[model samples]
Target: MKKVLMGMAIASSLATMMFVPNQAQAAVEANIGATSNYLWRGVSQSADSASVSGGIDYSDDSGFYAGTWVGSLGDGNGAETDFYLGFGGESGDFGYDVGYILYHYADLDDGDFGEVYFNGSYADFSFGVAYTVNSQVDDGSLFDTGDIYYSVGYGFEVAKEYSVGLTYGYYDFDAGSDSDYGHLQVDISKGDFTFSVSRADEDSGDDDTKFVVSWGTTF
Candidate 1:
């Protein structure tokens, strides 16, 4: 997906990205991006700082796709790499996607995880959910099967080439209800550049409202 459009919606939670391959033919694509701050599921992955990222994706007309993305973790020289595969298609204005993803953090202990996601969309509105299915944490019980996230989003063009998007997301953890959190995001974009602002609920451990400028392109 294009970064600007992807940012305007909630598709999945994997290094700030989710993919649904719906191309009509087999294709290979590459993309690169830079963000003032890398936020994943409403949490700053770049410590409220800047980060650079890039990825390559492959898709087939049959709705099968796979991709890998990597980016600076904003924690010193640490980095995060992600791999995902999924199937997606549309009938008229409605579409659906199902996928699995894995996240790996280099030089970060206990930071690896795996999730499965489902998404459905109609027109400009979208809904999605992801469940944690694997973890590298030592306390696996607390980080286990009960972790899940839900999200909703809507996007529309405000002008010929300018657009606005609104998104809301919630997280639930098995550890405790107190650990749950939610966030809202707004995005405005034209072409390959985007401006965005988001805020996480106080329960998310970080209540700060974040603003970000980002540019991305694919070929």
Candidate 2:
């Protein structure tokens, strides 16, 4: 049932991106990267190990966009594939984004879900909210609809081609335990290549503080 809904959502987004005649000037982009650990929302997704990731995106001048991302998830977790569609535009000094994202775990049966999110940013500061709409895990025992996450972030340039960022997030679950976490990151870019170091603080369950390094490029 959940899988069916997931398929429908992806199909709908794809159709919209492909058939939307107004987006005739759409541009395509691709990115690839490697990370020492795959951390998602402050939780380790790659069992604290390294992973490879990549994605492709389509965007137009009208603020509509769609993309697909994939990452290797070490050991028994298999791979993670994400599909998202959104529209983002600037208003004065603020930018807003609204979108739906589906996370599909290949070879990890019952470990898939979807979320709808709204994000706003001004200058170097940002805030966002996400709500889980569906979960495929063990009949939604591990993750269920209505789970919400709130986040705030800030970033600043420290030097030429270097920057620092901070992020904090709180997860409120409808079925499971809740958690609060924070992340500090530093990034350096040279041409098309970027290097990053990120540290996360865990505030609940067995999640622990950890650090990760990564390198990536976009084309």
Candidate 3:
């Protein structure tokens, strides 16, 4: 329980740049943003603690992109930073992404974990599958520890400056263990600033609910 809470806190401290647009033939973008909770694919990326994350991206029109991102996390294991390298492409309404997620700890007792993920999005719906290549799980013997997740989201315009959305995802892992999560989000934009609020829920034996709020700007 303490570890979970600490993860969330570290997630909130890491500011990260996501959703970079490639307008020019060869484009590069730098970004920095923070979120109250680090939720990735319906699972808490942070230890249920606040986390801040950020990174930069470079992309080309040939459908190749690469970037690195880092964040702080809370855990007795001492690994407080995470880094990832990924590539993604969009073909009309369909898109595909593949990346590596690496968890680096500072303590010796806790080892690092790395995973690979592939994701697809069509219109407002997205789905993905992930595999732990070098799972730093407590027990390294856990093999074939893969995860599947899917999400669907649509946005509604409210007034000229406000919009709301509903997003949901389902996660299933090895054995019969599975979890479902949903989010209700609202976005308000004025000029160069955008503010958002989201509520996330996880349905499982240890169900957890969280509320997140964030403010960001785009160049």
Identify the leading candidate in terms of lDDT: 1
- 141: Cα error in model 3, Å: 8.5
Q: How many clashes show up in model 3?
A: 30
For model 2, name the residue pairs that clash.
none
Runs of candidate 3 with Cα error greater than 4 angstroms are: 1-23, 41-49, 74-80, 107-111, 140-144, 175-208
Q: lDDT score, residue 133, model 1? A: 90
Worst 10 residues of 1 by lDDT: 1-10
Per-model TM-score versus the true fold: 0.89, 0.79, 0.66
> Which candidate model has the greater lDDT, 2 or 3?
2
Clashing residue pairs, candidate 1?
none
Roughly what TM-score does model 1 have, to 2 decimal places? 0.89
Better of 2 and 3 by TM-score: 2
- How close to the true structure is residue 17 of candidate 2, measured as C-alpha lDDT? 21
Per-residue lDDT of candidate 1, residues 29-91 (tens digit) = 998888888877677776677888888999998998899888775547477788889888888
What TM-score does prediction 2 earn? Answer: 0.79
List model 3 lDDT by residue over 55-93, tens digit each: 666777665667655555534333245566567677798
- How do the candidates rank by TM-score, highest first? 1, 2, 3
lDDT of candidate 1 at residue 5, scale 0 to 100: 9
Model 1, runs deviating above 4 Å? 1-22, 140-143, 203-205
